[model samples]
Target: MPLSVVDLYRDVLPRTNCKDCGFPTCLAFASMVVSEKLPLKNCPHIDPETAARCQKELDAQHAAGKWTRRDMAEDALQWAREKAASMALTDLPERIGGRLHGDGPDRELHLPYFSEFIRIGAGGIRKENGEPLNRWEQVFVYNHMAQGGRTNPTGNWKAFQEIPNTVSKVKSMRAHVEAPLAERFGGKAETLGRAAMRLGGRDLTNESRAADAVWRFTPLPRVPVMLLFWDRADEFDAKVTLLFDETVTDHLDIESILFLSERLTQLLCEDGTG
Candidate 1:
């Protein structure tokens, strides 16, 4: 079996929160070594002989393509494709709010993804411009299709913790979606607002909570996400919070929702304004 990050941290590394390895924790270093291709020799505390043995195993695993993040993502996309294959293309228009085009083997659903659109067919998911989607984007769209989009947005928003079975993903929501936005747009509400609006988001600052900036976005026809941002204050860091419609799970699961929010962050940050 290939050595996982956890296995490397627990079985090989010292498991100390030592910063000697130029990482905040041994587990962080282990994760980088396993997933990000960080050299194991970077950890000064590990014995040279043990490091050699583990590095050799990691090399063999990499050579065999048994331990790679891209491989895992591709596997996930394949699984989602299988599930989405069973969905009826004809029914997707009303279920997910997309236009069906072509006929027979050339059929596909052209669904609005933020400000852009994507083409989903039996072959694969791609951008409306005929650009192929990455594994993560493909997985997100496929999972959305596989869910059948059973319900519409209720317009009632709730925090990430308010959603069922989402306690584990709260940290991920902050790290991947909230923190990055807060860091990028803190004290720059105008820039953030412009970027948000560029992606078809609506300004809701007047009606929402006492946030410095508030925007609601409909990435999908049925999936609405609201973002609330606060500028940095005395002794308090800036913050960004996301709220989802109460019926969001009816269209997408928690994992897909996280990915959706992360994608939103990516788009807003890529707007090149701030």
Candidate 2:
């Protein structure tokens, strides 16, 4: 006889429900499990041993090209995590503040700055419009820069100018945010670049080169947009040109740059103030 939902729940579920599986009860999940509509792995509290057993069984069903409840659960969890990670920081008060401040006046804006080189056509041609250049490029780039802080003379504007050392700061921020999030998503830092490339419909082939390509992506949910900057050095003159990925304009309105600047200023203040 085939296993009933009750039997599956008794044997497979942690019996805690806990909503960790995103279902109301273990019985509900069990029903889905028996129907091959959900995966037992979705139950976060289930012991690893039991999960392994359930997975093994599910894998066998899958090997025969049959859909199992386990696959559905896995797919649901993946969708949830992806949605969470893609959530815009603008929705979080800690990240973007509660209210939108109008673009009124004076403030300091900090942007991302980095150095790198752009290799064209793989020939290593170093001349652009008849000028000698180096492989290193320097750029002052910002993901989001808008009006921030008071109009006081001692505001972020003054500090912003002094903080060209944004590279170390950005690196620190990326280190703090990327690792744990990547682990949760079953991915690594490289996954972000791959996703960006896919979204941009461009191929990034030369990532292993000596030049450390600094890419910054900031998503503003309030404005419903994404901002990206690619900094690299010219092979001939060695000048750095901050290139805005054209794809960004397609997704985000350029007018949002004002708010972006403000949000970035807030970020700088928080990072420095602490």
Candidate 3:
């Protein structure tokens, strides 16, 4: 099918996230294949029939020049635009956990982000002050369009590892997110709390368990991130556990979750908050 990547990898792939294919995960490989980033022969595990079919499909895709990173990113952006524009202005606030303003075409979808309300609409997003966002922050806008949430955070949170499809990405998540978080504020309990609070996160130390510091943040409306830190000790390794609302996948894919976590870590460290 056109929606698939050559159709051979789905059933034949080992799904092992082995980087033998030059991609971190098999899913990433599939996306790259669909984007024509790698040829099918790189996997080395596919049978001759599958390999040949993959080559044929790859050729077809390349001939059309339809599957490139730039092409796909543009497509995703266009999709976000269309989806946001097509959504019913009135129902958006309730459906996606954002606040709506105005009526008809003048309506704007506003979501709480860090310390501000990001205003989004068919014309694209801007800050409450009408300033534009960099490409990095635009992911939040795209996610807001794609999210299909209808409920609120249930207050129950779990680590990213608890989420489906994130099992294979745990190591990378740690390296990019948890590790940095721990490095910066693992033993500095006060700094951790201060940085989190700077991000508009609420300190929930009194309500949480076994945590040196715990802060809750609604980074993107329905999407909440819980920063839970266990201070380093002689008996225990220092750790930073980022937990998400149990229903996070209902609003975003696992990749988006990873993106948010990694970006949050980077922001905290780079902004000198961590």
Number of backbone collisions per candidate: 0, 29, 0
Highest lDDT against the true fold, candidate: 1
Question: In terms of TM-score, which candidate is strongest?
Answer: 1
In terms of lDDT, model 2 sits at 0.36
Write the residue-wise lDDT of candidate 1 on 1-274 in tens digits: 6788999989988887889988999988888887777889999888999899999988878777665556678788888888888888898998889899999999998898788888888778888788898777777778888894668777888999899999999999989989999999877888998898899998989886658888989888888889999999898889999999999888788888888888889999999395
Q: Candidate 2, residues 145-258: lDDT per residue as tens digits?
A: 122211112111111112333444444333433322222223222443444343322322354232233333332222221222232235422111122332333222232232
TM-scores, all candidates, are: 0.76, 0.22, 0.67
Runs in model 1 with CA error above 4 Å? 1-70
RMSD of each: 5.8, 19.7, 9.2
Q: Which segments of candidate 3 are over 4 A away from where they belong?
A: 1-76, 82-85, 235-237
Q: What range of 10 consecutive residues in model 1 has the weakest lDDT sum? A: 62-71
Candidate 3 global lDDT: 0.75
Off by over 4 Å in 2: 1-4, 62-274
Sorted on lDDT, highest at the top, how do the candidates line up? 1, 3, 2
**Root mean square deviation (Cα) for candidate 3:** 9.2
